[model samples]
Target: MQSTVNYLWHTDDLLGQGATASVYKARNKKSGELVAVKVFNTASYLRPREVQVREFEVLRKLNHQNIVKLFAVEETGGSRQKVLVMEYCSSGSLLSVLESPENAFGLPEEEFLVVLRCVAHVNALSGPKDSLPPKVSPRHEAVPGQRASSPLSAVAGMNHLRENGIVHRDIKPGNILRLLGEEGQSIYKLTDFGAARELDDDEKFVSVYGTEEYLHPDMYERAVLRKPQQKTFGVTVDLWSIGVTLYHAATGSLPFVPFGGPRRNKEMMYRITTEKPAGAIAGTQKEENGPLEWSYTLPVTCRLSLGLQSQLVPILANILEVEQAKCWGFDQFFAETSDILQRVIVHVFSLSQAVLHHVYIHAHNTIAIFLEAVYEQTRVAPQHQKFLFEGHFWVLEPNLSAQHIAHTTASSPLTLLSTASETPKGLAFKDPAQDIPKFFPKVDLQADYTTAKSVLGAGYQALWLARTLLAGQELMLRGLYWCVETFQATCRRTLEVTRMALLFLSSSLGTERFSSVAGMTEMQELKKVTELRSRLRALAEALSRCSHSITESQTSLSNLRSELLKNRDQVHADRSIQQIQYCLDKMNLIYKQFKKSRMRPGLGYNEEQIHKLDKVNFSRLAKRLLQLFQETCVQKYQTSLVTHGRWMREVHETRNHLRMVGCSVAAYNTEAQGAQESLSKILDQVSHQLLQDRTREAQVSPPLTAPYPSPALTDLVLQMQELCEEMKLLAFDLQDNNRVIEGLSRPPSAPDS
Candidate 1:
């Protein structure tokens, strides 16, 4: 190790070490300013000379807040050692935060946003100069029309890089440094351009070098396969690596791991080239043989809201797309991120207003009724009560503009009354008759008042009604305000969570692997699994919609119950009860749809299915069948599987259909033997022998490969007939469940009946 006083800059402490370089905390000997010195051992280390030169060239051109600034470079010991002094980051690398137990759940959503901005900045800096006009120097001021508050600030930084024709090939959590803003906010900077390179006019690069986990699938293919034609890839490759980095920062884990172990680099590379990354979609089952044992749960410590998760998963998906044409560029990514933030803000604000409107409408009616009762009892005119309420108490504004009453107080009761009289119609107050018809059509107020009096005894009832109305009004307003605040907080949290999840999903599952004859079968299966998973997602969404509808109906029912208790109107209560029952019926239909959709069997067993199979012989049989299928079909037809993609699709569809049939059989018959026999029959019909025979014949004769022979088609058609018969039995069971739901949908029997 070099001494602190060995160079022009005095080294204070060791920061970190990598294969080619070691970074140290240092200060300028003259200026005494803190800095980071990345020292490379050119003679002893592997690729240190090349990396150091590359870093020097790239850093010399880039000068942005997000990209690390190069302060100075020094060479010593006859140029055997090279040191590049750069801006010191006190907050350390993002990897430190991700590794911390304190931040085990990953960085908060806001921090993720900072990271995104940083990525966008790097990408912008790498863009073609002519395509984007020159902005203010990034080191001095932010770009015009760019708000520091906007996450899009990062995009400006990336645009700068793009214009300069630089590609930061190695983008990962470990390479991203964090700086603390004056406000204590995180400011991320993209550092370590060791693998970065400048592209030529052809706009393509052949060199495949980056961290293994962050490498794009195409890059992996280029490097591992060593195909000259496929070696050249575009700048979009950087987006994939950034996506991976973002995901790791968000989820505190890499998206793709080697299937077996860390030593399986070839396997990992092959997987990267040939398949979709594992754990990309939220709430889906990961393959058992998948690289990592991923938690189905999102980070509990950094818990993201459902809304954010929904927005982010798709964004990452788009960026990490395997098809370069389908993948998002800097422009699309910047637009999408901006849209996500804007949409979330708008949605939260809109939702808050809608809730406030609901509360205001209810509160306005309650206050009106309370005022009317007071006027009747005290012989006070309605106008006098309205004036007093608007000025002294609460205003009856349907829009909840009553919140501003404190700021817009009147001089006296007389002045308030005059102001109200002059106020525009429907602004401060509306005709009671008109409002009453809108809220409660054809309802007689007189009858309601009479019933209320009878329920609680006349004199005491008016006092109770007044007290209840006043207390409820205050409570409702307070609750409404609280809900708005809560929603605002949730929305903020959701935005962060979504940003993080997008990064995670993108890194884990975003990139598309190349298709090869060897892994074609797995790819086909992946496609089938993806299709089934989508249906499952649809089922889950339907269930979520149903739950939301039920929640709304329940809230309305609770409010109606409160009214019924206070007013004691049998007719109104009955009518409201019927409406709730109708809601229940609608919910049942949704449930039925969910159930039907849920029958689209996943490639692997879900938690529920796994639990159901526990301690059952069927579980063992299913496992055996799965193993046999993998061996017989997957292994033998692995190469030809690509050629027979349609045949493989049929196989998966038949397998799922068989599983469904088995489930039905197990439900009706306690005898495992019966279910086993059904599975055996289905397996035999779609067995490896049939697939093998077809494959062998195809290899022997090319003409037979075009279409299935009459005998084989006849056998497949007969199997389909058997499948239909089994489905008929399951249909009968479905009908039974539907009949039970129908019975529940009927009107409730009266107590007298």
Candidate 2:
């Protein structure tokens, strides 16, 4: 080993001493280059020659930017140890920089980005693809079955190493070194591969390998701190080391600190392997909401300005997904970073005042919506709306101007936004009625009045529809109030929702998955129950008003019918009994018709089926009335205009009949009435015939005309009676029509139209 060291680096000077080796700062006597030298300790006598040969073989086969470079080994006569020589870096280790603040070792955001890039680049170089010499058993696990490289390179290099039957057992950051190349750039070098091993070798695996802090928890627990090696576990030990390295990089701390003696190592290992990682011990802060909160200072050098901190938290959280399998790997990390950087660059270079102007103009719209919403919540105030519009415009103009500042970045965006919020220029001490001087009085009028009215109408339609369909009347009212306030207050805030939706879509935002079917079921039930309650209240109010109106109309019609009958029965009256009865009937019929028109419909379990049954009954009623009218009155005109008109009028009033075909004049018969005695006999015969013939057809179809004559009732009583009967039939028809309408119409709270 001494001769090999002399061959590698010619000179050596003692620098420090350690348990395993004597370290020195050395220079190549021949080449005048600096290096480090270490001589094997004399006290270690357990197969020293074999260990030295193994170390040389492993180190020589490994080469990486992040790994320390091995030069040579030499042996000298009369010396009890061999010497190992390697390249030396002047800046020392990350450990030294952390321990001493005086090293002037502070990295700004940009510098930090460079560091991360360098680390990523180094990990890419010495990855697991090198074809070198092999040694030991289970080469996939070098240090008792682990890798001897930094955790970052383990997984990437693992499959390649395993394919070639090589394993690194001592994966840790300390063994990783950074070198300066042509441009004074840092490069990584992976060093100290003494514990590497080969697969298919049947030697008993020793547990006394690998750094205690970096060992896999399972391995540590079973190895019992090297007291008695356990014969379990596999190549996943490298994953544990990788986890440890990530932990350190994210939070500048080890998983655990070493303390006590070698026996303490056993306790530490057992704790690591058995206990779960205490998340609270890490530097990531936590709020009551439970999501991890990063400190104000970010570790990476991102292009986002300080003002954009809030915008960046979510991005970071996604990249650092808590789930190990879901976490971003090299490809994902680089891709996402490149995307963000591109956006930043484009924003800086290509952005013009036009963009900011558009944004501010859009903001004006959003503010308008906000104002309308506010008005909806409170009270309608046109003055307030006008004030808000003017104020918003005032605030926006300068903000837009500021956002257009040349070379604007994330840091300046918020600043410009804030500036807009503060000055509000023309709005300060300016009355809305007094149109501000200069800067778009005409444009402002168009945006605030003409455009506002159109936008408000459309926006209100959507908002009200959503509220009425998904919420209740009260909520619908609230939505209206909100729209009005939005239109009035912020003037431009109406566009915020549109912008937010676009941004979220671009961001590829995802929602968390629901955990159970029971949760979904409960949500559905809650919605149904709420809707049911609202419907019940609305139905109750409608029923009450309908009942009262029907009763009042019924009483009024009864009195009027009585008055008509009394007038017809007067002995001194000149009118005939038939004429009087006709007049009274007509009056009664009109009264009944009016009363039926007032009746509203109800809803519930059997409402629909009941409505269908009523339709059939109404057809029967129409037939009976037609029979009575034909027999009682003489038809003058070829068409029964009154009957047809009444039917058409009823059809118009009946919402259910609106879509149905109206009756034609040809469907009604024009026949003269006979004398009273002869008419009675004729009525009986006609009624019988109608029952057997017309009733059947009528039962299956709607009548084309009212079943009463329009002009044959000279006597008020007869007219009133005929009118009453006709009205009764029409009333039934109207009620049935209403029932059908109520049945077909969906509940007010139905989700979709």
Candidate 3:
């Protein structure tokens, strides 16, 4: 036996030492497994035998996922010392993690939540831990066996002790150890129950036992007396210590302190803690003469999101209150901490000017989103989105991970960098009243005879006024159509963001094997259920508003561009025979040039062809001059003044259309940002519910994949069908994002217009 012990463990491999025992790293010879062995000192052997027996009995009986396991016990030969074997936690104690420099302001939100969910709640839930699908994620191990006692403590820490009627006199950070799993997942376990004692009922007392800084005021006051004070400690002592330990974990400092430090002046620490103002939850007075400051708020620099802080502060307050009568009972603390564990977290994004948007995401989502948001709102590309975290522009190096950034990443707004700018030319409003004089040119009757003889003729004035005013109104109509299309586009994009989030959550429920743990289920029911319902109803309402946004444009520019072009054909040359002959000759010359250019580049238009083109140009001008001289060609027109009324009406109608379109676009961005927040929150809620539901359902259900599902459960088919529809929508959203990214260099080619 001595030879095996010598071979398995090295003499110098001491892990830690204390007054009662020294822990050493060792391995099992038979199993080839690593373990820790604690050998008692000579003096510990001389103590009362039941004290040692009670310690071992507690370790053996309290088996939980959150409690460390007991492997076996053996004695070393020659030394006559009793040796205890225990599970080895490769990761150090929780104190070591808190001492890290980055955590000087407390854990980042991501890390804090990990600790909150896994260690803080300490639930004795059913089913195995780390139940996520093997290929998709790493596994977390649960305790090897079940607890012999009832699982009464949902908020069990000391609740672990509370359930077993055991009170751990010391519940500080150093006593809480961490175990690293094979996959590198760490599980926190309540350890070192050397001062723990079992009670018969809820109301019980014992001699004061704990570290000074974390000890409750009642316990500390008695512990430090020169002549020991007569006072009894109960299960509630653990509650107070639990509060202090958690506060230290959260903000990297103790909540209550006095002159100098707790170690230097333990009496002062007791007075400050027990004699604070009625409602104060936390306090510290660093100097002997310094005034004490008290408040209910967590330090502002703590990485918890504002939304989460609102939930957690109340829980901390109830537990940490100096007034013992007001402190929350065990059941209340359990329920509240469990609430913190369930819900998916939310992060806030603040753009310049304190405009905030909520999203269900963390720091690891993507860097592209910030740049996208800037471009989408401002149409400003070539932008650099400098991220500010911890008061400096966050240089996102490879080492700076999403977890380090905390739970601040979320659904981000994005826009394409357009190489070509697009300004949708909507309706143009013009007053024909100002433009009418160009057609008539204000001139005295005698002056017009010398300098403006051509314009003075009534026929020319009537023809010009009708043609010019009609042309201007036709252009405005084209712009009005463009505005209608743009509004339709914005509406569709908003709907897609909302729909995709819901679909992804639904699809994930059907496809994945979710983690079955405490609090996983309730996070599924976020308060945003009403927000989701409101958003759906509002979508239908928006359709009508968008239609009204373009209402005036439709009536004002009712004519299509195709109709405007076709109307021009009948007006040219009025079907005269001479004009038809001239058009046919021009068409013949154009066709010859088209044939030459199509067959080869720069091969058309020889010197002979150029000479013919020059002759044609000279002949056309000469014919036009001859027309002015001939009296028979001169024609007369009247009522050119009557076109003024029609032109003025077109101008007024176009302006009204422009006003409505402007308002719709101006309001779109604010609406989109709000809708994004509500949808993101709703998606997170549904995802948690699905995970919890699946975990509980899987525990007793038949192999859902058995050759056939249970014949009595006919709804399985319906469930599968609903999930299939959700999966299809989720797939479409993913593919859409890919398509958008690929097309960002240029827009997709427009269909033939």
> Among these predicted structures, which one has the highest lDDT?
3
RMSD of each: 38.3, 37.2, 38.2
Ranking by lDDT: 3, 1, 2
TM-scores, one per candidate: 0.43, 0.35, 0.46
Q: Report the C-alpha lDDT of model 1 over 486-555, residue by residue, as the tens digit.
A: 2233223322322332232232222232112113233232344344324334433433343343344335
CA deviation > 4 Å runs, candidate 3: 1-11, 118-161, 348-753
User: lDDT (0-100) at residue 644 of candidate 1?
Assistant: 26
Candidate 3 or 1, higher lDDT: 3
Alpha-carbon lDDT of model 1: 0.46
Off by over 4 Å in 1: 1-12, 43-52, 77-80, 124-155, 222-230, 258-269, 277-302, 341-753
- lDDT of candidate 2 over 1-753, digit per residue (tens): 233434343234454454566656776757768787766766644555776577677667655445567888765445636777887765555433322211112222333333444333333222233233222222121123332333344333323343434445666656555456788865545455566655332223444457766775545654444455555433334444544543444334453443432244456434433433323222221232233322333332122233232223333433323333433343333333322222221111001010111011111123343233323322333132211111121122222222222332322221111101111111001111122112222212222232222222222222222221222212212222222232222212212221322232222112111122123233333343334324333433433343344344334434433533443343223322234244334433433332343353433447435433433343333333333333322221112223223322332233122112111100110010111122233323433443344456656675669653223222322433343343344334433334433332221221110
Clashes of 3: 6
